[model samples]
Target: MFLLEKLFGGKSSAKVNAIKMLPAAYAEMVGDAGHCQLKRLHPALGVFELHFSTANGEKYACQMTACVAGVDIVFAANNRSVLVSPPFSLAKLRPVFDIALADR
Candidate 1:
């Protein structure tokens, strides 16, 4: 639930590359359906969204917006009925960033 800049320095290429290397199962979980979800929620400007279903059938949605120094990420469950906003410094969110990279 952290921003990409906190771990990836706002490099879109790295993120895309990371996603391209995900395991097949995980990749499938975030396939076309998930891409549609993300597209539906992404802001016209500096925002990004992503959706995925877990192995147990639970679904998650993540929304992020670009900030001056970084991006702000919010995670939600149940189609965004529940939301959690977790702010991260540009160097403090590598794990989540890695997950995003793998999922993108």
Candidate 2:
């Protein structure tokens, strides 16, 4: 079985744990609420990538590295870079994890 510890934007622990239970190598989450594609970059490295976008046109490409509380995210947008933590919301940006996941 594969388990994911957490997911950004997921409101409750119950929901997060539910996502982890999906029997797939990678899970694709898309809905009116948002779009998120999650996959393990490397289990040992504890790295994962989350490509998510909200209802608007805002776009973000994020890389999450495993850390203590949760993963640390390196976010890139409008040619700008910033580091953020979990529970961060980008409800309007469009995530293209399929492409981002493939490029890495």
* Candidate that scores best on TM-score: 2
Candidate 2: stretches off by over 4 Å: 1-31, 67-104
- Give candidate 1's root-mean-square deviation (CA, Å): 10.2
Mind giving the per-residue lDDT tens digits that candidate 2 earns over 10-102? 324432332233212123345464555565644334355565556775545556543233454443433443444444334211232333444
Candidate 2 has its poorest 10 consecutive residues by lDDT at 17-26
Candidate 2 residue 46 Cα shift, in angstroms, is 1.0
Backbone clashes for every candidate come to 1, 4
Clashing pairs in 2: 53-93, 54-91, 54-93, 58-93
lDDT of 1 by residue, 1-104 (tens): 56544454344533322322223334444444433134332222335555556555666555544333233333222233211123332223323334443433
Q: How many angstroms is residue 42 displaced in model 2 relative to the true structure, after the best TM-score fit?
A: 1.0
Model 1 lowest lDDT segment of ten: 76-85
True-structure RMSD, every candidate:
10.2, 10.1
